[model samples]
Target: MPTTALQDQLERGVAALGLALPAGAVQRLLDYRALLERWNAAYNLTAVRDPAEQVTRHLLDSLAILPYVQGDTLADLGTGPGLPGIPLAIAAPGRQVLLVDSNGKKVRFLREAIRALKLEGVQAVQSRVEDVPGQFDCITARAFASLADMLAWGGRLLAPRGVWLAMKGQAPDEELPGVPAGFAVRAVHALAVPGLAARRHLVVLGRDTA
Candidate 1:
């Protein structure tokens, strides 16, 4: 599909999801998609090549969790080319987002996207999830690692009462047993990303108050 048509699809999909995105949010996401396509040609930022597929997989897939995401600060661990982080930041310009990835090339692409998008409260940091500093009220991990490893490496970075939104392709029941201490699965939400048929689930974990 042409870029304009793909963007039109995106606008409709966003509305279908009932997301009241701030002004220019959809356009910025479209801009980010264009940047990803351009950079992927040279830097190989992402495996998804088609712009229309990206609109469904990358843009809508990320936005599907917008309703669950809350708080003022968020961290996107292993955010290669800023999957959900960049889009989330674009949607909620008020929240601060840290896009953390160790790869140099991917981080470079993220930095370029951040600058080109002119996203205010978003930064791409090249650091391992375990080594990144500061605590966030909400943390997002998309196919980064298993539940245990993700929390083991970055659990300390989550605020005392923070929520961890882990995006998974399917129900990760096997990984549930290994959730580290001090955390528990609060909810498992099945995400319905527009135009994509694959099973998508968001595992919501919260600090165990007990």
Candidate 2:
């Protein structure tokens, strides 16, 4: 597909999501996609190969949860190649984003992406989610792990009143029962990503205040 077509697809998808991004965000998004594509050929960072699919599955799919993302700091646990982290950072330049993954190659790609894209306020760390220190106002885990395990590992990183956004393929009804204690399911939002027909859901979890 042509570069223009990819840009058009991304633009349409962004519009469909009802998000008004900051100036130059669109171009940055495209640049990020291009970088991912280039690195993917040799590194196999992501299974999604086609550029068009990258726009739909990677970029737009990540932005679908933008409306619900809150707080000034976000930690993307197990962010392989910075799926939602990089895209979210590009979309919201002001927010501080931390991309965490244990894979050496992926972390290297993330650093390069951050430097190449000049994404200020974004940092990539190579550490297990459970070992990552500090708290974030918002946390995102995309198909990284089950609700039970994710919370069990990285639950401590969520700040008081912070929100955890777990991206899954379907409503995780079975997984709900396994959610660790001290965390409650705030809501489950069905995401409608443009140019893709797969069921996407965002499970919002928060620390139990009661």
Candidate 3:
């Protein structure tokens, strides 16, 4: 499919899920994706190369967790090619998004995408999840780490009343018990990504009690 057509289709798909995205931002996302595909051949930044899959799997998967993201300032850990973070920023232009990843190459790709898209309210930073500076209202991870490790190494990055939105497959049943005492796990809602083979869950983790 042509890039413009695919872009329109993506907007329709997202709207079908009750999420409305701005037309210019959708076009920017499509342009960014096109650039990403071209760069992926040499950068090896992402495993997902197919254009259609990029929409349903990567883009949609990210937006599906939008409601769960609790703050104006958000951090996306292990944000390879800015999965949920970039897409989320595109969808919600008002939210400030920091895309953090340890891999220098992936961070480079993210920087390039940000410039290419001329995206507002987006920043790319290179750092480990644990050592990343500043606090965030919400932190997101996709195929980044086990829930246990996220709470361990990355938990401190969240603001005092922040939430953690994790996109994972199969619900991660065995991992819930290991969260730190302050953090509690709740609301495992299935995601509705089209053409996705595995079951997706938007796992919500948070700590509001002192």
Candidate 4:
């Protein structure tokens, strides 16, 4: 994806989305895309490449949940390449973002993207998913796991009233019979991530005994 053309399209898309980013923010995403492509040559960072998909799928797809979040702090689990976390931070600059991933290389790329984007209040930590103890105002993940498994593994890290935003491809069909008690599924909403194939949706879960 060429810089000029991508910039033009990004300008329109960002405006349409009613967001005003810094001068070079779109460039940073493009740079990140380039880096991903380069790293994929050896590191195999991500299988998604095409520029539009990078913006719509990788970037906006993660951002689709921005409207649903209502806090200043967030943590992303298994944030392979900073999916919703990075994009979330970009959309909400005041947020304190904690991105966690066990893979050192992926964390390195995340750190690089953070630096390139000049995104404040962002931290990329290299650690296992279950090891992050402190709670966050909100927690987000893409392709993490089934609702039950994710709650089983990462539920404790959520603030007493915090919400878990999981980006999924399919609408959660069957009720999670084994999903531990006290946690409730709040809402299921469809996410229209342009330039991607799979249907996207968001699952909002929190500590509710209903």
Candidate 5:
């Protein structure tokens, strides 16, 4: 698809999501997508190939959870090619975003994207999720792992009052029972991503105070 069409699709999707992004966020998002596409050709960053599909499955799909995102610090665990992390940073500029992944190639692409897009507060770290230190007010895991395992590995990074946003294709009802102790399901939202029809859900979890 042409760049203009992709922009149109992204704009409509953002509007449908009821998000009013920064003035140039839409264009910057497209630029990020282009970078991902180019890198994916050589490094195989993501499974999705087509550019239009990238907008639907990657860009809009990531932006779908924007409304639920909170706090000034966000850590995207298993951020392969910076899925929701990069898009979220583009849409919400001021928040500090940390994209973590063990894959060196993916991290390299993420760094290039951050620099090319001039995303000031974003940083890419090539490391396992468990070893990434520091607490974040919001944490995103995009189809990275089962809820049980994700919490077991990176749960420590979530602030006492922070939220964990787990993006999944379907509601992980079976995994709810396996959520490790000290964390509870706050809510589960069915995301409606534009230009694509697929089951998408965001499982919100928080530290269990009681």
Candidate 6:
């Protein structure tokens, strides 16, 4: 399929999800896809090559969690190639998003993507999740680690009453037992990525009241 078809599909997909993005958001997403493809050749940023598949797997797959996202500040931990972080940032221009990753090359790509995309209120930082400074109202991790380990490394970064959105292939039943103290699994949402056949789930975690 042509790039225009993919863009049209994306626009329809976002609309189907009942999310209203800004005027140029879809264009930015397409631009981001192109940048990812261009950089992937040299940096090995992602294994998926077909642009149409990327639209579904990479772009829409990340955008699936758009409705569940909350708050003004978000940190996408281990944001390799800026998956949901870049897409989410493009959708919500007013929100402050920080893409945190320890890999130098990935962070470099993220920086260049941010620059080329002209994504405002976004930054790419090179740091381990545990070492990242400050707090954010929302944090996202895409198969970066087990739910337990992800919180262990970055739980402190979640502000009081903040939420952690962990994207997974399926319900992480076993990892629930290993959740560290001071946190609770708020909810588990089964996400349906437009045009994606595989299962997708988002585990919501927040500070424990007890």
TM-score for each model: 0.98, 0.99, 0.94, 0.89, 0.98, 0.97
Summarize candidate 1's per-residue lDDT along 32-96 as a digit string, tens digits.
Answer: 99889888899988889988899999999999999989899999999998989999999888889
lDDT of 2 by residue, 111-186 (tens): 9999999999999999998799999999999999999999999999999989999999988999999998899999
Q: Sort by lDDT, best first.
A: 2, 5, 1, 6, 3, 4
The number of clashing residue pairs in each candidate reads: 0, 0, 0, 0, 0, 0
Flag clash pairs in model 1: none
lDDT of 6 by residue, 1-210 (tens): 787898889998897778899998999999999999998999999999999889998989899998888999999999999988999998878889999999999999999998888888999999988789999999999989998899888999999989999999978888898999999999988988888889999999999998
lDDT of 4 by residue, 177-210 (tens): 6556778878889976645568988888889755
TM-score of model number 6: 0.97
User: What value of lDDT does candidate 1 attain over all alpha carbons?
Assistant: 0.92
Candidate 5's C-alpha runs over 4 A off are: none
Segments of candidate 3 deviating more than 4 angstroms: 208-210
- TM-score for model 1? 0.98
Least well predicted 10-residue stretch by lDDT in candidate 3: 16-25
| Clashes in predicted model 5 | 0
**How does each model score on lDDT?**
0.92, 0.94, 0.83, 0.79, 0.94, 0.91
Error of 6 at 173 (Å): 1.2
Give the per-residue lDDT digits (tens) of candidate 5, residues 1-210: 989999998999899989999999999999989988889889998899999999999999999999999999999999999989999999888999999999999999999999899999999999999899899999999999999999999999999999999999988999999999999999999988988788999999999999
RMSD of each: 0.8, 0.6, 1.5, 2.1, 0.7, 0.9
Candidate 1: 10-residue stretch with minimal lDDT: 1-10
Give Cα distance to truth, residue 206, candidate 6, Å: 0.3
